[model samples]
Target: MPNLKIEESNSLISKAVIMTGEAPSAEAVPVSTTRTGQMMWKDTFYAGEPDIEAVFDVDTEAIQLYQSQASIKYGSIAAGYSVLYAAFLAMGLYGIASVCLVIAFVFGVLTRLTCKRATAAFNTGGIHMAITSSCVRYDQEKPMVSTAIAVQDITTCTVEQRELKPYCGLFGTNKTINLIHLRVANGSSSKRYVGVKDPRNFARLVMTIKNRPRSAAPPVASSEIVFR
Candidate 1:
């Protein structure tokens, strides 16, 4: 399969990366207008009817839109090692040259592998969320993006409006755009951004339900959901 990097990352398979500064903007949509859950609010991305209590919506920014940060760094490492290996081989240092070659190969593999699984979710690409009492489920459109968030893992959720030219340029305007920062208890570096119609209210909604205990709903399979 051809390895694909989401513009920011370097991909050996891709000769050049074309960047267009297009801010991803979409109006927040209701999961179900006719069928409302007591606690769960689901988009078409989720399957199975558990009457899962759906709550407020979260317009998510996919990790696939961000994780290319490491691609060029790894590619540079591989290239540096390959150059050192060539120099060593030319100087009759076969043992060291072989080791350098091995290191180069390892880094090369990592450069390729980093293009996949940028987020915890499986190829997710939706901007809206299917919310529950304790978790926020996202829709998947492309691969390597996040799919869900456990509310218990969250320590605090806050929105910071800033004017910036982000790496992906997925969401930002000439004026300050709302960037909701969801800090976790474990302090994991991996984070997903979200764009919503009203960021302050969205952040408030997340905090209000952040402490609710998760439901004992049956897990939904990816293949089972119908992607809209």
Candidate 2:
């Protein structure tokens, strides 16, 4: 049977298996309405109900929108300089035109390269559920840092504005998840404070997934923790 497994550092918590045959009817949950950004978790398996729910205020996502400064740098003014220099050179304005073209070419290449890096950094393409036992790996005998925060430590959560159709690029502060930065308690840590696009729905969905009955409780087979 396909089961939801959590890999961990400690053998005891290394691989906790959960029967996910009874998960919610939803095939895939829509994470962010702001489809503008790549889907965080595309196709992933998550344990059902009673999973930890952490809501941090710190927005972990590093989103990049078209900045005004960037616009100015690449705007009409810059284009005008290129045009004027090209025109001046055609009119026999010394070697100034050649220098202008070289500078433009160099900067253009640099701009393209910089944009590529920015795109890579902002690319979001995976689900980051709360850190599970598999992720902790107690067997390692060392503190673990996860890309996403653990749900168990989450005390309170709040969702702001569900109507903000983010997927459609509808702007205006529609929906937001405010979570507590877990790593903050430790002082200058590297743990990531990730965001769950739809905080309310995601929480409800997780609970449903984890809490689902495990095949009628296995018929109370033998009434023992282990059956040799």
Candidate 3:
């Protein structure tokens, strides 16, 4: 009789279970923070979600400034007209009062819409934003559409800031808000980052990180412009 030997590898992985293995780790996750802000998340969890293979920056300050500005704008419209409406009514000018009421209502509606957009953009308690070489993404729990935008698809990220003014007119506030207007390809599609105080830094980060594909250079027109 002959004795046979069988040695165990003691590894968690089994030889028979070779087809499936541990997933590969994501690359280039820095241990330190960037100059702009702090990184909140380095990876994504939800399916079909953003592939943020970089740091997720959280703004130190809340974006409530945007909503405040909107409120001021709408409040002015509503308040100015509301006073007129009240005066017209008190003066027994019912028709004029009705017209002022309608105008106020219309302007109030615009304010509501602006607030809604701001909510999606960055009205959350804190802005969770991430920028990779491939795309840009943010945490918008109730976004109008997908929150991720491919780098190539992004045409420009410009700062939409209100200049400092000592006073305001009856229709609007002195300084409305500071936001980032993100214009994507086709120009029609867009996104907004509301109440971002440092809009220039935000825009610069996105523009610098994203690597847009360059078009092939055209041939020189005067290459064959000789007398031949």
What lDDT does candidate 2 reach at residue 158?
A: 26
Models sorted by lDDT, best on top:
3, 1, 2
Instruction: Give the per-residue Cα lDDT of candidate 2 at 136.
Output: 15
What value of lDDT does candidate 1 attain over all alpha carbons?
Answer: 0.48
Sorted on TM-score, highest at the top, how do the candidates line up? 3, 1, 2
Per-residue lDDT of 136 in model 3: 69
TM-score of 2: 0.27
Q: What is the C-alpha lDDT profile of model 1 across 1-228, one tens digit per residue? A: 232211111111111111112232353223332221212223344446453334333333333333344555677899999999999999999999999999999988887755553443233433445445556565545442445677556655555554433464445443334455666668875344544334443443444454333359432211110001
Better of 1 and 3 by lDDT: 3
lDDT values, one for every candidate? 0.48, 0.34, 0.51
lDDT (tens digit, per residue) of candidate 2 on 1-228: 232222121112112232222333455432323313212332333425233222111122322222212333544344665886789788998588877776666656655543443343244432234433212110110122234333333322223322222332345555443321222223454232224343433333333223333455531111101000
Off by over 4 Å in 1: 1-28, 31-43, 47-65, 68-70, 89-110, 113-129, 138-147, 158-181, 186-190, 193-202, 212-228
CA deviation > 4 Å runs, candidate 2: 1-63, 66-72, 75-78, 125-228
Write down the TM-score of every candidate: 0.44, 0.27, 0.47
Candidate 3 residue-wise lDDT, 85-163, digit = tens: 9999999999999999999998888877656655654534334565554676665554444467776566556555554
Candidate 1: worst-modelled 10 consecutive residues by lDDT: 219-228
